[model samples]
Target: MLAWPAWLTILLLVTNLLSLAALFFVTRRMLKLRRQKKRAFAFSDYPVRKAKLEEIAPCFAMSGYGPSPDSEVRFIGGEGVVSSLSDRESWVMAALAKGVKRVFEFGTCSGKTTHVLALNAAPDSEIFTLTLHPDDLAATEFGFGDDREHRDIALSESSFETFYYNGRSSERHIRQIFSDSKSYNEAPLRGSVDLVFVDGAHTRSYVENDTRKALNMLADEGVILWHDYKPGVPGVFAFLNELSRTLPLVHIADTDLVMYRRVRKQLSPA
Candidate 1:
């Protein structure tokens, strides 16, 4: 049997260890809750009003017979495609592209959306798609406040040198601009684009920059769509929430896309 002192020592040590383990678990759980709270505070979706597809555009309204021809789009599955749009989102965009004369897209990741835009647009329509070349990631100008996670994702997604539309006939309609969107000039295309898709780097600075340029280039009746508006993507979620204050941004119901139609020409922020 152990001596009284030894028994006391063992009891104290065991008690200390159990207390430490409990404290460790409590600390871990507290940290997790704190992180969740911070995320909720930073990335919540209460700012933008959500709307059904028909509310955003008349083309999404159902015809008495069936889906309108404008809603019929040539679609490729997301299988083996990285960062592809959801089927519903693609349909919304393609339907919007129908009959549009000029479309501008920021961030041509895989060019899947660009191809869809071309397929649904008028045969003579031009699709201008911009993306950073994999070789030129060094040129990315990420701001200090940019979300680090998405900056990495932006670089990773830029790995495509050849896109989905590379050899297809849609290639004829797409003008691929290989440059960081921050450095690309929108002057030549100003007030001419009927549709604009802003899917570039999810960094706040990049979104702001591309949006300013999109506004400058938007035709009077043009539409702009921004992807990844959910809370999981902090950069897009927060930026668009703030943008909703000044612009009439609509979150498409059940999708991560936000839509805006210009009521009047707005000057780009200098």
Candidate 2:
């Protein structure tokens, strides 16, 4: 091989170093996808909700959300939190078991909680889960093998980026639609969305914004679930303020979660 001049050789070395840096960046992302967290379901040892299928059908019928069947979901938050999953996870399932017409969730962390909900949904009902993982790796990383078939979690990872400014996310690369505003061209879904659960962000502004976005999507008769309503989270309490006092809402049955129904009459009853 011919030897290069001193200055030219230095330039070549710099180029090589830059290329290495780029390669490392790509590799780090791949590793993140495979990385598994040590966090356990706060209620790992607690009993799973066991509402009989018969009990869940009626909630959906009354809600008029759509064709929601019986369903439940499991979530992992701070330690000992899910021990019984408190109301954040349970109350919704109880409602789902009551036969809510549809199920919608944000933040598909580890696929456990959403999976719980999907398993119980009525055969005709559907469960939709929004996750941070992209559409491509969703099947490979989040898919828990044969167990996934029944859950029917229509995955939507797009919203995580747009609504959250997930600029570097794979959603941009793959061109997927994550939010209804995107799908409907900056318009909300036609008609109304049945139920919405937003748990993706924990910060006050983030959670508050998500709540507003969900509100616009739900059917007038729909309900929305907000996670991380415990003490210390600024946004939880602030977001709650946006709701009218007369709206029908319940604090987490036994936990710090919160829920609201979309009844306009309840928005402000004198």
Candidate 3:
């Protein structure tokens, strides 16, 4: 057979390149769709506790379900802030705060949640929130064990220069700890906190570290809440998924919050 013409050979090469480019784009699109579906599926893995807003308030109680009288609660928030808690979540947290005496927050993005906690907690309650100042980014030290994706997210969300509670009355109740959570010691907080909110870094390593310390810092009957466990947050979702298997966790329906309660064990029969 005669050799192919130079023009034909050049055209065939270009066609192959175009075909490969199209295949690459199509494959990428499919992978993205798969990831979206996977994230949606993650929220369905745990049980959701559904209740009317009023039903969950600290004051509305029946025979077996009512907050203790000492538990005082008040909710404050809903200014359309992207980083703040949703109205329903704020209410749930406020009701829970009625029973909390010492609260710890892993991240204090704008201090909106912290303000809400202080507003609802007992009059003499105290709050400790950990976060990095915008100025400390250069000096911050993150965990080495975190996955690359998680570490990147944690770094991106670490800045906290302005806060809602900066001059508010609630500020009096809050003790802000400015430091990278990885290097922060848990010794002073161990076994004394009544509520811990893990909303700091979205990385797996940071989540694991914060969770371990939260458990250690928790009082015998304390509660822990983690945020951003919904779709698109892979690190938070993945870690909580593995954790929920062995720990008692309940997802609050229509929200991205998961709660774990440490129940006090009863003494053996006398």
lDDT-best of 1 and 2: 1
After superposition, candidate 2 runs with Cα above 4 Å error: 1-88, 134-191, 242-246, 264-270
lDDT of each: 0.90, 0.48, 0.79
Model 1, span 102-177: residue lDDT tens = 9999999889889989998999999999999999999999998898899999999998888989989999999999
TM-score on alpha carbons, each prediction: 0.79, 0.46, 0.73
Every candidate's CA RMSD:
7.7, 20.7, 9.6
In lDDT terms, which candidate is top? Answer: 1
Please, what's the RMSD in Å of model 3? 9.6
Q: Write the per-residue lDDT of candidate 2 for residues 74-188, one digit (tens) a residue.
A: 3234434221244445545545433445566666544344544544444455555555444443332222221232122323322233332234221221223343221223133
- RMSD from true fold, candidate 1: 7.7
Considering summed lDDT, which 10 consecutive residues are worst modelled in model 2?
Answer: 168-177
lDDT score, candidate 2, position 183? 23
Number of clashing pairs per prediction, in order: 0, 25, 0
Clash pairs detected, candidate 3? none
Total backbone clashes of model 2? Answer: 25
